[model samples]
Target: MRKIYFIALLLLCGNLYGQGLPGLGAGTTPNNKPILHGKNWVAITGKPLGATAGAAIFHQGGNAVDAACAMIAATSTMWDVLSWGGETQALIYNPHTKKVIAINALGYAPTGATVDFFKSQGMNNPPQYGPLAATTPGTPGGIMTMLAEYGTMSLEQILKPSMELAKGYPIEAQTANAIEAQKAKIKDWPYSKKIFLPHLGKEREAPEAGEIFVQEDLYQMLSKLVEAERNALKGSKSRKEAIYAAYDRFYKGDIAKEIVRGTREQGGLFTEADLANWKVKIEEPLHVNYKGIDVYKLQEWTQGPALLQSLNILENFDLKTMGYNSANYIHTLYQAMNLAFADRDFYYGDPAYVKSPMKGLLSKEYAKARAKLIGDMNDPKITAGDPYPYQGGTNPYLDILKKNQTKVASLSPGQINSTLDEQFISDFQSGTTSMETADAEGWVVSVTPSGGWIPAVVAGNTGVGLSQRMQSFVLDENLSPYNLPEPGKRPRVTLTPSLALKDGKPLLAFAVQGGDSQDQNLLQFFLNIVEFEMDVQEGTEAPNFNSYQMQSSFGDHEIRPGAIVLRKDTPEWISKELAKKGYSLEFWNKTSGPINAIWFDWKHSTFWGGSSDYGDDYGIAW
Candidate 1:
């Protein structure tokens, strides 16, 4: 009966297209959390304290960018799956320019990090953890670059709230538990052991929950940044110049020497020259107009463009008529995302180093061709389609695609009895965190900063964790010729923050922290709001499914072609229907990652905020 009604609804949606989205059903989806509304400002992050830190910045009269910088600093300090040494990527909607700018602070493979170097170590991929996996730190330079260019506050002011937390704060259970669980790994890195394991020989080697976990070294590191800025200010440098001074100190100055010393002590490849040469990039973001809304994403260096590709393909169908989360809706989304991800696996790479053919990948004609490949049932053999023809270019790597197809054909479904399932989940949703902020002045920010998770090797006494991002690189050129790790080249990452505009104004700012699943889930969350008209909170908490049809960006970099994950409460009929379509089913308590979003209600001139209930995400508004 539901299937029949959904088909009838599809017919209605076909005609209601001219009337705009959510035209078929306007029913509100109930949410466990209320929508956070604000007329002045709204801030959301991975933790309550991080949100509070943003609020503190707003209280001090900072704009959205400033508050977001504060939250990013605070969350990194709190060890919310990242540290000061992690990478930071952001999308800032500048009210002054009326343009959304992309910030690329992603760290690249450092000195001596070559494909032959890892292969010499008998590594198919780079080491997944520890010092040798480290990349040159990017977050410090990223933070300062964003602040100096787009933010109104000084660097010292932005770091103040996080610096205070570094001095002393009652540690949360999540971080404390993470430390304890990884104590064995943490103990191997000397400086990391000194910082993470407070009671080395005790049963609980890490700090207990609710303990005042003070990171004295981290505090000192933050002070040095502040001190640099102050010294520059005293010397009559401009606010922006002073921030760059701090950035310089971390990269080219004494701090850089210490980082190289510590990394070498742990057998890592980072060098002072690598740190000296690295700089954050500010680029024009890529965008595609779906219906009337313009959605923006970072370029190929990250997996963000996959979501745009999905949106372009989805534009061909009237999703409203499919009915949200129905078997048909889920199938369509899964298929579209898989098609996009397949393209991501083959074509996406660091644009600076390769011609990614993004023009064709985002073309409507290309999306139409890709969409036609989706069959009525799950396709266990879905692979990347050529986008070059649509972009007016000849394919240069057709041989690589043939290689990938052969590789995909050689593998059967991974056995459930093996550890592959656990590894799949880990690699698919590799850890990260996010922050979102918006203010009345129209300065909007969405950041997905990650790396330096638990058990990270600390570089010197700076208390900054080295990034394990090197694992995302593949050693074989057949996997990705563009992604083969080389000194000073970035690995294609999974961190993505989303922003949308309609009629030249900010409409939404959202981001989620899950490795391969980031774009897969975010695509659904976007349709839930734009097509179904759910409020921001409802859209954020709404049940979404994941497709693992493409190769993972982490770990083994393997593909589980038919594997899919859905909410546990998904109907039995839905489950049975999917299984019949050749899907290998999996269930999780929460299908959505830790998503955070702020919707700008143009009609009411207010902001509707949302943080995922599945994780410890929180928001503040005033």
Candidate 2:
């Protein structure tokens, strides 16, 4: 009888018209749109403009990898908030290699930069400028690396769509809103204002649905890269050298000079050598096994490790048996997330500078130990666990103390001694703050590039300020016993791209875009679908919650506020249950971080794709 019921459930799900759970509606769009509705592959993104560019590449015989490159190029021009020129991180699954690779397109601090260098200069708070703030821009290098290793199309071909769009693509409401939000800051940058604003001194408005917008300078830049590639192909320059030349043209050539001048004029620190020396690092992707399937994520420099840690913690629970979205399930997941985030705050950092015990943090044994702390009965106001020690005989608690001291000196001398220092108050005031896991077959590419701090000191020839990523660091108040100033490392990042597979084959790929909310959102989305059996649309649209009790690059640290934010659509019952469990509930009209996803239907050998309706965008495909 049990077997018969299981078969019935499967049959019910297969028939769309049957009394089955909600499923995503099917659709098709031209190849110029990034939505590819093929039986073998599909791709989706947060913006129609990006999706359109990727779709064009797909139609032109480019595979998923090529489409991804084109999508990112176009996105850089359209989504200014998530700028492509900043830093890019990606996870690519190559069916041919049957292996997953992580591309760390993120920039690193210049070699000349040290914690003491700023202090010696009498700079209490180092300006987010100059060589100190600048890291090697990694987007260009990362793109080239992926194309060289896995992409089929040439650079010229992949970049063409973005180039054309840059010449002029209609600005949308979302883009307009973003620009308006930053209007005051952007006006100061002549280049940004000139390119983004309309003629007659008026700020450009998003085109009414069907209108077209264009960025001529960006188009010229893309064209220049293409021209260089063509010349290099015809000349003696190697492909690598040609690619490098193009990158130099953007960063060290006239364009770079402009940025440098602007930065220096603003008292910022970025030198030509900083740009020249920058390169994206290629590292082995971190992996974790969940429910018997291998899961892949980026390294510690990113929040990928945290995702794995959370998954490991949850592995001890049979989610299916807990019941999807039930009070019990939500509490369990929240507990696991709290524990994972604690580890993320304490240990995760740039692997090059800090020793992160990633292996132990993601171990099954560690997860079990953490999980045993959770009560199956009531949700606690706070979840606590002993600090997981780092290997090599280093205690994390001591490290935290040292980190505190170093950060205090950077902010204020007295700030280190007291948690409630005025410097802490000022630092809190200074706070400023993508998902497709798809294979290359019909690639679902999700790329998120973010600009660091505002008012970059780098000057462009056009007098535009460049990105100031150096602000990403947190100063440690504690000094090493050796008297070396502790450099506050890059906090655990929230950017993570993930792929889910079943039986060694790619089943679903998805990611989210909210700052620290990325991993939490991704985890919830997966659980909504795999364990809850909700369809793509339902899963993506479901109301979500985020916990601020753990450490974050943003928000209050000491008071784990037990806050739970809910979307407008959260069921009343769920809200009541959460409130009953001592969760401070807050509601948001909607959250940012548009999720794009693609799923494979094994029995039919067809592909399905969906872009979040939460934004003013649509998906496309051939």
Candidate 3:
């Protein structure tokens, strides 16, 4: 009965062509745009302009990877939620090779970012804003690497749309509001102020929705790469060599020098060696088999495994029998998510530095044992399970866990110390944008681009932005390999991207941009599609829930026990019932996620795409 109703609802959606979600600046665009269908290629991004740019690239003789790179570059230029100076993490699937590659393009801590360095500066945790929070940017290198290895276009061509957009593009209402919100932060940094808040003769203000906002400095920064690529192609250089030239220009050339100088002059510890030494790592994806499908994620460095662990526990139950979003379904989902997140808090970190037992954590036996801990009532405590006992492996984090579990401060020392610090205000927020692209040839790319917000200082006059990823690092001196401040360490990031394969063929690619709610958003959306059989857009539009039972990956790693918030659109009775079951309930209009995803039906030779209505997420195909 539900399946029949969903099909009928999809028919109704087919007529609401291109309509934006209510109150999200829907404009007067057509309302009949349903799940976009494509024959050869399709692209979807957090912004419509970005989707158009990427689709144009695909139509202009580029492949899926090229289109994806182009889309990321275009979105970065819009400068609302994403910045060119930010970092990205990607999950790419190549059907011809039957390979799913995970790209950890997240920025790394600078060489001087040791624990002693912060102690010497009388700091406990890393700074929340300014140059001290900055890291060696990995976005440029990540994109360049994708172009050289998998893409069929030069950096010059792929960046053309972004370069043009940077010169000037009509701003949107959402972007204008974002700029307005960051005015104070922009004013604090002269470089950010000059770029985002332009002076119109006598007065300076954020750009209006319809205004043509120009970014000459950003254009100059991007133009340097094109020039370097062109120069490298002068004689006997391959396209790959030209791409490397462009990459080196950003990481090892004048760009790197300017970043190092500006950062150092502003009391930042980043140096030329830091910039030159950083590289994007390509690793095998961390995956879990769920309901006969293989779900892959960005790896342990992020909250990716949390998604797998949650799904592992969920797979033990008959979700369809529980009914979609029913009281029982919601309860079981949160229990599984809480368990997985508990493990994430305790075990997930950069595998290079920490010994994360992947095989043990994702095992079905471990999940069953963990699921048994979820009682008939709600669990308010942040309890983590012992996967090592089931897998016959010794616990690596045992000593630190025992030492810090009880003593871990409610708030990190930095959060307490920086409370009155103007630079570290409570209202500050950083954002990220997501882009996904796929072609009929079976190539799929899910990229989450982030960083370079007004909160972080710009790297000199080069128009480059640096990441404050260091803020996610824990600053305690407990001697734990995980979550410590150390040089060359990748912070436990929340930038999780996902891919799903059915019978060894790539079928779905998706990702969203929410700091703490990323995994929860993905989990709900995944269930909507897999169990409920909802189409991409309907699943994205579905009311979502967020559980705050685990430690946050951002500033202070605050934990709020038994607190679960649901979208206001959820039934009121459900909230009341969950509250009665020892769960603290709250209502929010939007907290779970604003997700974007693409589904490929290889047997039908067609593509189906969806984007959340929360933002200006746009989906297009050709």
TM-score of each: 0.95, 0.80, 0.90
Q: In model 2, which range of ten residues has the least summed lDDT?
A: 477-486
Ranked by lDDT, the better of candidates 1 and 3 is 1
lDDT per residue as tens, model 2, 406-503: 54336532322212334333322221115353433634444555543332322443322244455444444321211112233333345677877778
Candidate 1, residues 1-622, lDDT tens digits: the string is 9999998675644322212245434334457877889999999999999999999999999999999999999999999999988999999999988999999999998988998899898888998889888888989988899999988999999999889998989999999999998888998999999988889788788999999998898898888999999999999999999999999999998888899999999999888899999989999999999999999999899999999999999888877777777677778888898899888887888787886989999999999998888778987777787888998888899888888777667756553221237767887788799999999999999999998999799999998998989988888878777678889888899999999999999988999988999998788888878887877887888778888878888888887767788888777877898888878888889987888999988999999999889889999998
| Candidate 3 lDDT tens digits, 439-531 | 878789998877775555777787776677787787773523566767788888778889999999876788887776888889989887787
Steric clash pairs (candidate 1): none
lDDT of 3: 0.77
Task: Sort the predicted structures by TM-score, highest score first.
Answer: 1, 3, 2
Report, for every candidate in turn, its global Cα lDDT versus the true structure: 0.87, 0.60, 0.77
Model 1: worst 10 consecutive residues (lDDT sum): 12-21
Q: Point out where model 1 deviates above 4 Å.
A: 1-28, 406-420
**How much is 345 displaced in model 3, in angstroms?**
1.5
Tell me the lDDT of model 1 at 202: 80
